[model samples]
Target: MVERMKTYKAIKYTLFVCCYLFWVASAVLIAVGVYAKIAKEGDVVDSLTADPALLLISTGSLMFIITFFGCFGALRNGVPLLKLFLGILVAILLMQIAAAVLGFLFSDLVLERTEQLMAKGIARYREDLDLENLIDFVQKKFQCCGVHTYKDWSGNVYFKCSETNPSLEGCGVPFSCCIQWKNESVLNTMCGYETQTLEERIAKDSIHTTGCLDKIVRWGKRNLILVGGMTVGLLGLEIFMICLAAAQISRIRGKVKTVNSRRRAR
Candidate 1:
């Protein structure tokens, strides 16, 4: 009986420690997100649809609430709280599986929606600093230009190729699209200037004329194994946590039953 009790205590504390660590992490995420929102309030409002800080805050808040239930339930051996936590975990797992299946079955639709979002982002490129930086980073990393092609920059007001466009950046892509030079110490922000006016064959030599979406798709395919492994690892960890909580609940109930029976006998 003492051995069984010891085992129960071990499981309980282990679960507590795991939940506690996640709770701390969630708190930190929330803090950083709040700080970002406050520091760049103007920028965040402008990019409301694509604000990274808002994403962080929402994700962190959900994690914080879930981990709180896990921690409190484990420490107090509260059956209801533990059951709630287990149910939430199961629901999340199901949602993830459903999303993955839907994404696979409707890949074309997914791509189309992604393209639309990317186009919107491009259109508002100059309106949001965060979005601008994000687009530039992706372009440089993938060595690609606009959504479908370099010419797609025409969607942006400042980059429109119309003769009436007065902006100096008119008909030009961002510097990120430029072909980086070897051993270059400084970036030539104007390297992409007026490149859109050139023929495709000629422009390819100076800047990346390929679409970013194609490059991203190819990159994903090449790293499929890594992505799949990470997904599987996360699912396995969640399953393990669910099992631990279930076992602890059973132990608590069994102990309660034993105590009640002994009291009735007396």
Candidate 2:
């Protein structure tokens, strides 16, 4: 009995540590999402469509609340709370499976929607400095420009290719679209200026003429194995925790039953 108690205690403490770390990670995710939303420069759109930050905040908040129940339920050895946690975890797992199936069935629609959201972001780039910086960073990191192609910058009024536009940046992509030279220490902010008006051959040499949508799609395809591996690993961890919690609950109940049997015998 003492050995059983020791084993139970060890499992409980280990589960507590794991759940506590999950809680902390969720909290950090929420904080980063909030900071991104609040510190964003310029116009704030409260629209809930395709905003990664909002999605992160929502997911993190949900995880934090659910994991709170799991952590405390294990620490206190509360049967009811543990049962609730188990139910929720199962439901979440099922929902994730359903989502994956749906995503596979409607991949084309998903890609189209993704492109639309990206185009919307580009259009609203000037309205939010944070968004602008984010778009610029994506372009630089991906080594791609615009949504479908560099010509898609015409969607942005500031970069619209027209001789009549008043903005000096008319027909010009952001500096991020410019070819980055290895030895060059300074970025020429105006490197993309007037490049949109040039011929395709010339523009391709100076700027990334390819679109980001295709590059992003390609990247996702290339890393499918990695993403799938991570997903499986996380699900495996969750299942292990559930099994651990269930074992602890059973151990406690059996010990209680043994004590009750002894009392009845006496």
Per-residue lDDT tens digits for candidate 1, residues 157-218, read 99999899999999999999999989888999999888889999999999999999999999
Candidate 2: misplaced stretches above 4 Å? Answer: 50-52
TM-score each candidate.
0.91, 0.87
Highest lDDT among the candidates is held by which one?
1
Please report, as a residue range, the 10-residue window in candidate 1 with the lowest summed lDDT. Answer: 40-49
TM-score of 2: 0.87
Best by TM-score: 1
